[model samples]
Every structure is written in structure tokens, then in C-alpha cells.
Target: MNFSTELIFALATILLIPIYYYFTKLRRIEKFFENFPNPPTVPILGNARDFRSGPAFFKSIHEYTRKYGNMVHIKIGPIGHVLLASDYKFLEFLLSHNKLLTKSINLKFLEPWIGTGLVTANGGPKWKTHRRLITPAFHFKILEQFVDIFESAGNILIQKLSKESGEKSVDIYPYVTRCTLDVICETAMGTKVDVQNSETSLYFHSVKEMCRIFLARTTSILKRYDSIFRFTKDYEIQKKSVEVLHGYTKSVINSKRKELEETRKEGNYSDVDDLGRKKKKVFLDLILEATVDGQSLSDEEIREEVDTFMFGGHDTTATATSFILYCLGQNKDVQDKVLEEQEQIFGGEKCPKVTYTNLQEMKYLENVIKEGLRLYSPVPLFGRRIDQDVEYDGKIIPNGVGVIVFSHGIHMNPEYYPNPEKFDPSRFDNVEGKQPFAFIPFSAGPRNCIGQKYAMLEIKCLLSKIVRNFELSPAFPRHEMILAPETVLKSLNGVKIGIKSR
Candidate 1:
């Protein structure tokens, strides 16, 4: 062959090797799951066509689990086999497995935005060390200090919503999201962006756009691969979003570091501030002081964790808070009970300083939030990559497969929850012998969300403020929310409700 012909042949051989090996491995997985239940899939395309959109994928997965049983074997284009599971027993096994701690490949989509932060880190020494270093940051003492920030943000949210009250209807998602953004920014990074008041908040808009891009990328098979995705418009959008996100995080990290150094040099790094009150340390302060592998973390490392915190800290809580408002709006009885409890605690003080002790006493409101999370988990699904054979239902689930823990499905299973469609906070009132893994809105296991407690506290504070200040009713009483699957769960139709000053 001529030089050009030989070069083309060599390149083809190089590319074909992986393809040959991939199909060969795929066949083995196919054989292992030959008898496993699954939806009807076309050849080559597998089940890709069924989940061509985010909403379709989310709806279909739930349907497939309900029809084909809890454990459904699904094939997605060239991505190979995934064990979609909603069974509590199977989820408990997979999530608690010591070896199955690695997150699935789907999380790679978030890497551009979050980098290799705790959420995206694989199971290894690095993950362990980072987890160890970061765990203390969420101590009760530190979290107690965040209540002021939460209350402050919530008051701002209530003021903004006051203008919208008495209108036909208003979508509470944007208002709640901006409020949570402000809380997370100040609490997590010790910087106040005031997203709720800022008319042109680049970081807030970028976050929302990035979530949209993530949903778009997941639904389209062509966009799953970097080679094709980079050529698309979503990639361009993602590139811009990442620049804003990363740029903002890096700047915050640098500023925080300088502040830390100044404090230490001034011999004012004691536990108390100039006012003699105990100084509250933000999450970023802990990260800046942390050491890994006998060395202090670099700015990039600090930025990764801060970015992860910003992403996880705000969006999930915002989604949860919005859904809780929707549920309360739909069920006036529950709302009244919550308001009564708020009254007993705050006692006619609208938007009182919700102390940690006060939060502990809002028992009924806590259950309401729990019920909302049960009905509408912010993260509907999360997955893990199995590295070894797993035994379930007297069958061996071979290694090298992805196991998706369908939290939404588990929450809706009538066996675990009677009349699962109904919204009842009382279900959580008595949980003497309920399965622990059955209700995992923050997931279960060693890798469960570290910020879960912080999230709950923030949600409670915001809900307390809103519920105390306004009387809520559903905009579309009988209409259901059109669920859209994104990094955080969102309603495509917007979470709308009617509001007026109480």
C-alpha cells in the first residue's frame, strides 16, 4: 500500500481495537443478564429511543421499574448495561457495599462544573482523606452559626414574595432558588452575593443554564460523548457556564485565603471575633486550613470543594423548599398545622430568629418537609459502579455494571408506603421499625450527602419564614407538576402557588 493508504489503515486498526474489545465485553454482560427483566429494546440502539428526552427518560425509568420489577436491566446506546433498581433490599446492599463505592460514569457530566470534588470523587484514598478532612466542618457548633444566615436569607425571600402576593399566581421556584443561593454563598464561602436582590446575577443565571445544558446532554445520545458534544451549542453554553462558575469560585477562594492569613498574622485567629463572640467559621475556612497527604491543599483543591458546596448546597435545598411549599399549598390542613406549630414556637412573632432549639421544636414542620422530600426528592436518582459480583434474589449480578438507586421509585413503592400517591406528613410520625434504607432522600451509606443536615436546617428556616408570613393555596389545585430531570429535580411548568399575607 502507498504511504497515505498505510496511514489510514493503521489509524483504523488503532480505533477498531477498542471497538472490538468493547463489543466482546458487552456480549458477556448481555449473556449474564440474558434472563433479567427489561423493557423491549431495539437492536444496536438498545433502549436509547425510549429515553430520548429528560422527561421521557425519567418517566420511562419509573414505568419500567413498576412493570419489569425493581431490578430492570437496561441498555443505553453504546453505554452498555445498567441495573436500574428501586428495591430497598438491593439498594441497601449496593449503597452499603464497601467495594461498590465508586460513582457511575454518568456523574462525569458534572465534572466540568464541579471538577473532582467530593461528590464526583471515586472511592479511594483521596476520597477517604478528603471526607475525613471535611467531615468536621459540619459539626453542630458550626451548623448552629448558620441559622442566622438562613433566617436572614429567608426574610429577604419573604420580602420579595410580598410583591407577588395577591397576584393570580406566582412561581416560587425562582424566588426560593435565589434565596438559597444567597444562603449557600455566605455560609459556604463567607461571601454574600445577594442573589435574591441582584437583578443581573451571572452566577445564578449560569447555574440555571448549566442545569438545562446537563438535562439536554443526558437526553440526547449524540451529546453523551465529548467528541460530538463539543461541536454542539450545549457545549458552548456549558463552556461559558463553567467559566463563570470556576472563575467566581477561584476568586472567592483567593480572597478567603488572604483573610485567613491576615487573621493569623494579627494574632486574632482565636475562637472569638473582635466583638468577643465566638467566630463562626464558614465551610471555606475549614477547607483552607485542611491538610491532605501531609501538605496543605492548593487553591484549586479548595475551589473544587467550594464549587461542589455551592452546587450541592443551594440547588438541592431550593428544590426541596419549593416542593414543600407546593405540598403545603395543596394541603391546607397540613399548612395550618404547620402554622399552628410555628405559632406555638415563635408565638405571634412573624419570621422570628429561628434558634437551633426552636428548629428542634418545630416537629410537625419537620415532618412536613420530610413528606415533601419523600414525594419529591431533589435528586431523584443516583448510581454506583459495581466492581465485583453482587448476589441478589438468588442470582449473581456480575461485575462492571452500573447500579442505579431509584430513590423516587423506592419512595413511591406502596409496599413501603401505603397510598404512596398521597401526601401525608404523619407517615413519618411513627417509624419504630421502618427500613432505614427505604427513605433516603439524601441517599444512604458512607457517601450520603454531607450537607444533608445543613440543607434540612435551611429548608426549615425558609419554610418557617414563608409559612408564618403568608397563607398559601395551590394555583392549580388538581394539576400535577410536570417533573423534569436535571442535576437537581425541577418542575417544567414551574412550582406555582397563590400567596397573601397571613
Candidate 2:
């Protein structure tokens, strides 16, 4: 045979083997899936066609749920069986299971950017040790120190918003994103990138691009494989983003390491800033000082944790805060209640420096934030790999399958929250009787978000400042954000709102 024919034969052989194995595996698992409802699938392509784009995948999942039951089985070609579940009982079982801690392959897309950080790391000894060491960094006392940073960033946000405060509709997402970026940089690295003041932020832009690329690559089956993805334009963008993101993080790590070495040798290490004021220990500082089994973490390990926090901290909180503001704009009565609660705490002070005690006192505002999180979870979907056969509702979910917890579906389920569409803060007023996994904006159980408390505090602080100083209204009085399920929840049409000085 000629060389060209030989090459074609070799490639076909390589592809055919996997195809054959997947078909065989499908036959073995198809029996379990037979008991579950799923959308109609093509013979070999299965539902793979529906996942060519992120929006399509998101829309199809919802459509399938509406047509099928809450738990919909799907076959996506070689990716294998997936059970999209929003049932709270199944969710509680899946999330709380000690053995079901391995994340699915879908999240493997993030490893290039974050590199097996806590979020993407499987349930193993390293995850357990890292979790143990990092948990202390988010202690309530430590989180209290970041409140000043939150207030400082919130002040910058309010000033920027003041410039845009008028009859004109303003897209608050970018402003909120910058504020959260600034806050994360200062609190996570003890470095100020000043994202809010800069007309453009490279780190901010790179993070956004990375998230966009992840969503795209995740939904496209071909793009999920590095060999194929490397040939695409999205891969080029993703590679550039990683370079920018990792370069910035590595430089910060080197600088902090050098500073620690010098200060410790001099016996003059001080957690005090200029003006003789004590400085708060950042997440980087904690990681730097941490030692596991009598050996400190390497630079790469440190970078992984810092990048994870930086990625986790900014965008998710910013999205939540923006949606909370959007929720407030949509419901004037709820905003009025939030304002009344804020008045009782700050005594009608306009954008006062928020305190931890003050935050604790704003009980009603806390419920508003909780209600906002329920309505628009920043992370709408996350999943775990089924390592072994598990029985739920007397049906077996076979091994080698992935189960994606549809958080948005759970939040919108009327069984969990009556009239789930309404923006009712009172629903959170008494969550004592609520199902544990029913309202998981931060997720639930062991692998839940470690920085959740910190996130909540920061959102509360920022929202309090904005609501205190401004009267918000929907941009069109009937304005509704077009929810787009990306790496983080987004509004395609923009989180537009009208703001006026209160």
C-alpha cells in the first residue's frame, strides 16, 4: 500500500477501537439506563449532537428535564452515560457520599488552567491534606479581617457607580467584576492589581477569556481532547490565557517567597502595614507559612491553591452580587425591606464602612442574599463520577457513569420552594425545615466550596453599600436577565438596571 493509504488505515484503526469499546460498554450499561427516562438518541451519535455548544447543551438539558423526569439519562457518544439529576434526595446522597468524591471528566477541561487544584482534584490523600491545611485560612476571625478589604473595594465600586448613576440603564456586571477582582487580588495575594481603577486589566481579561473558552471546549466533544483542541482557535486563546494567568501568579509567588525569606531572617517580620496599622494575612501568606508532614509546599503547589482561590473568589462572588442587585431592582418591596434592615444596622448612614458585627446584625439582608443565591446560583451545574454501582430509589446507577447535579433545576423546583420563581426573601427566613441539598448555591457536603462564608460576607458587604446609597430599578420595568449557563452563570443581555441616588 502507498504511504497515504497506510496512514489512513492506521488512523481509522486508532479511532475504531475506541468506538467499538464504547459501543460494547454501552450495551452493558444500557440496561440500567433503560429504567430511566432520556431524550431520544441516535444509534451511535446518541445525544452528542446536542452538546456542540454550551448554550445548546444547557437548553437541551432543561428541555429534557421538562419532557423527561427530573432525572434524565443521556448517552453522549464515547463520553458514556450521564444522569442529569435535580432530585434533592439523589443530590443529598451523591454530594454527601464519602466514596463518591471523584469529579467527572467534564471538569478535566479546567486542569490546564488550574492544574489539579482543590476544585478539580479528585478525592484522595492530597485533597484531604490540602483541605485540612487550607480550611484554617477561612476561619471566621480570618474572614473578619477581609471585611476591611471588602469595604475598600465596595467604596471603589460605589464611586464608579456614582458616575453612571442616572436615568440611563447601566450594565453593572463589569463594574462588579472589577471590584471583586480587586478584592480577590488584595485578599488572596496581598497584592493590589487595582482592577477597578485601571481602564483595562490583563488578569481580569484573561480570566474571563479562560472561562469562556472552558465553556466552549467543555460542550464540544472534539474540543474536549487536547490533541484535537490544540488545532482550534479556541485552543490558541486558551493557551494565551494560561500563559498570562500563570505568569502573573508565578511572579507574585516568587515575590512573596523572597519577602518571607528576608523578613524572617531579619527577625523583623511584621504583619503591619504603613501608618503602623496591622496588615491582614492573605490566603497566600497562610499557604506560604503552611507545612505538610514537616515539609513546605513547593512553588507549583502554592500556585495551584492561590490560582484556585483567585479563580473561585472573584467571578462567582461578582456574579452573585450582580444578580442580587438585579433581584433587588426587580422587587422594590424586598429592596425596601433590605434598606430598612440596613437602616437599623447603620442608622441610615450612607455607605458606611461595614463591620463584621454590622453584617451579623443585618438578618433580613442575609435572607435577601440567600434568596438571591437560590434564584441564580453562580455555578449552575457540577458533577461527580460514579466510581461504583449505587442504588437510589431502588434503582441501580451503574459504575462508570457521571452524575451532574443540576443546581438551577433544584432551585426552581416548586417542591423545594413554593413559587420558586418569585423573589421572596421570606422563603429563607425559616430554612430550618428545608431539605439540606435543596438550596445548594454553594453546594453541599464535604466537597462544598471552602470559601463560601467569605463569599457570603463579601457579597453582603457590597450589596449593603450599593443598596444603602442607591435606589435601583429594572432597566425596562419588566427587564429580565437572559440566563446563560457558562462556567459561571451570566446574563447574555447584560444585567441592566437603572440607578438613582437615594
Candidate 3:
């Protein structure tokens, strides 16, 4: 009886192959769907349900690619997701129209958190205008000025960590967040909140809470549709928290506006803010610098850009730094290479000024940062809607429907990097012949990260300074902390590591 039962089960497994093929072919014949490069999805809800179900993404995505080809199509309800897990096609599509494809607006969750900033703004005139207006502020020469703020903040962080170095392990999450908060405050709002030492600054805390809520609550349909849940706990927290942020920004803008009046009167017209007070010469001043133009952005517009930069400019870079440290801790050979690179650059010397030029000098360091981004991507996926009917993959992806792309799959494809799981930076070497879209840490094309130069500068400085003194080790297992989905970015188990002076 047992032998007969086993024989029947084996026969059933063989029979199912044709059944599976018939269904897959039938779905294609239906033509409303496509295949994605991952494990066989459960149809309709596809991989979306798996992601929404839990945090086994690294394994899930890997499993899918092994079964399916490099690029897979998935449908969750009416939504279409093109998981370009392979390297070449992903890069081709991304780089070919970096401005259009790299610009994502299909997701429902980002609307609130990003509002109208670079990350979530629509791609046409509004973005162009905002991008144009804000471009001058981040000009390389101008960004060079912000390095002092980053360096100063970096030092404060080092000092605090130095005191706690003997500690078994430290939550570098807050420390890194503080460092970035300090940068944004000085760069965006013109108010230098020293969050480095006091991790609980009001705005800083609010930003964190808001980011947490936004990620937890944003549903894809709502951003595409109008199903935003006003009463939900996630929505409520995000709305109130964003309001707090807006209110603070308004106060700052008001002060700047008043001071702008005084400066105009004085004729010298050096930057100032409301209440006739002096403020840090930051991005706020630069935005207000052009308020005289009749076409200046509205207060809402200004705030949106500010909010966008605050989240976009800082969070991913922070994650990148944290991941870099994690990778360094795990791979001692790579870490040693980094340390050797650092020592050569700053031999027995104090932390450098961290100018734009210094960042270019640290080529190996840049590769390390890129490798970290690939493994534990800050944003594992980016979504977009085709504004007009466009031909893609020999099919017309009709306008207005949602389309999602996966970096988690794209970066891990063996075609782009050999042994995609390993932490290797050499792949980025002689990137000249590399396909246009293969590597996009900050994205590519017109709408890519505006403050990328600023971000790299800060990363280079922090790494240089940190490597000069201490070696890094992992906080704990990377999987222990779940990746909390947020409006802006991702984080892992609070990336704690032991710190010791070299």
C-alpha cells in the first residue's frame, strides 16, 4: 500500500508539469499579464503578497531568479511589475531614458512623504521648474561650502562615540541619522540643530517617527487612486507629523521672508530670514534668494522641495554608510583594502577638509560604497507610470496603469556582476564600457539625485575620518532587524559595530 501511494505521488508530480505550462501559456494568451524573473508567483497578487506578507525578501527574490529568467513579469491585481533582475536590460531601460524611467510616480505611499519633492514629484514641468530653481544651490562650488558643516558634525559624532568606544556595541543608526539631520538642518533649513549629541531633537525625532509611519501605511492603490486612508493610524501619524514639519518650516520661512525685506532695504541684501533675524546661509536662503522673481515657487512648493531634499538627500546616503560599515565588518579583506586606501590618503594626518576634490581621490572608497548599495539597497524598488502609451518589450504599456521595477533583483543579477551575492567592488573598475544603467546608486539621467555630489562628499569625509581612528565590526546579524519600509529608505537591524582606535 505504501509503495502504491508513493508511485501515485510521483506520477502526479510528472503530470503537473504539463498543467503548469498550459496555465502559464494560457495566461500569456490572455495578454493582460507578463512573467517576472523570480519564483513562480501565485498569480494575480503574484509576488506582491509575498512582500506584503513578510521580510524574507532577500531569499524570496533570490529564489525567484533561480527558477525564472532574469526578467520576470508579475501582476498583483491590475498592477504590473517588471522585475529586471538581469543586468543588461535593466541598465538599458534605466539609462536610455534616465529622466523618464528613473522618475517614479506610480506608488501610492510616496505621495504624502515626498509630496512634490524630487523623489515623488511628477516628471514634467513642475519637476523641471523645481529642479531648475534648486540647481544653483547645489552647484559644486556651493556644495563645497557645506563640507564644513558635515566635518563639524562628523567630529561631534566621533567624540561622542569615542567616549562610548569601550562599550560592547553601539547603535550607529541614531548616530548616523543625527549626522545626516545635522547636515540637512544646515543645508536645507539654515538652522544647525546639533542632533549629533542630542539624538532627540524635536524635528529630528518627528522626522524619524513620520518616516516610520509613512512606510508602514502607504498603500500602492491610494497613491495611484484616491484611497488615502485619513483615519488609519499610519496616515494619522504621518499627516500630523508632516504638519509639524511643515509648521516648523513655515515659521522658518516666515522669519526668512521678514528678514528678506530688511536685507532688500539695506541694499547690500545679504541673506536673512523672518523676524528681522540672522540665519545660517543655507539652502533656504538660496531658495529665497530668488523670491524676487515673479515666477518664484509658492510657499508650499518651497516647503515640498525642502522636505524632498531632507528625506531624499540624507536617508539613502545614511543607509549606504551604515551598509558600507556592515560590509566592512564582515569582509576583513575588503575592510583592510579600505583601511590601506585611507592611510595612504591621510597618512598620520588629521581628518582632511573633505572638499569635493578629496572625494574624487578616494576611488576605491567609492567602489566600496557602491557595492554596499547593491547588496542592501536603500530603495529596493522604484515605481513609475507611463504618461503616454509607450512601446516596451514589444508590448504597448498603456498609459495610466502602474509599473514597478526591482533593484533588488536587478543588482543581484549574475550578468552584471559575477557572484552577485559576494561583496566585490572591483566590478565597478573601468566603468567606461559598463552599460548605461547597470549601476545606479544615485540613479541616472536628468532627475537623478541633485545633491549626489554633497552626499558623496559627506560619505568620503566620514569614512576617511572614521577609518583613520577605528576599525568597524557588525552590530549583529543583518537579518535580526527587519527592514522597516518607510517613505524614503530602508534600514537593517540598526547596524551596530564595535569601534576601536587604530
> Would you estimate the TM-scores of all the predictions?
0.94, 0.92, 0.82
Which of candidates 1 and 2 is the stronger one according to TM-score? 1
RMSD of each: 2.5, 3.3, 10.3
Spell out the clash pairs found in candidate 2.
Answer: none
Q: What C-alpha lDDT values do all the predictions have?
A: 0.86, 0.87, 0.68
Error of 3 at 237 (Å): 2.3
> In angstroms, how far off is 124's CA in candidate 2?
1.3
lDDT of 2 by residue, 1-502 (tens): 9999999999999999978976766565778777789788888888888876556777788788878978998887844788899987788888998878998787788887888889989989888888888999999989989999999989999999999988898999999999999999999998889989988788888988888888877777688888999999988888889999999999999999998899899898677776898777899988899887887778998898898998889989999999999989989999998898888877979967678999988889889998989988899888788877878788777777778889988888888788888989898777876687998998888999999999999999999999999999989555667777887888887898999999
Best by lDDT: 2
Compute the lDDT of residue 348 as modeled in candidate 1. Answer: 97
For residues 1-502, could you state the per-residue lDDT of candidate 1 as single tens digits? 8999999999999999988977866566777777679789898889878876668888999899889998899987655788888988888887777767889777788889988889989988877888888988898888999999988888888899999989468899999999989999999888889888898999898988877776666666689899999999888889999999999888888888898899889877588877899888899998898776677677887788888898788889999999999999999999999999988887899956678889989889889999999999999998788777777678776678777788999999999999998999999998855798999999988999998989888898899889999999989454478896788788988999999898
- Best first by lDDT, ranked: 2, 1, 3
List, residue by residue over 356-416, the lDDT tens digit for candidate 3: 6766688998888778878777777666555565566777544443444556666776777
| Winning model by TM-score | 1
TM-score of 3: 0.82
lDDT of 3 at 118: 65
Q: For every model in order, what is the number of clashing pairs?
A: 0, 0, 14
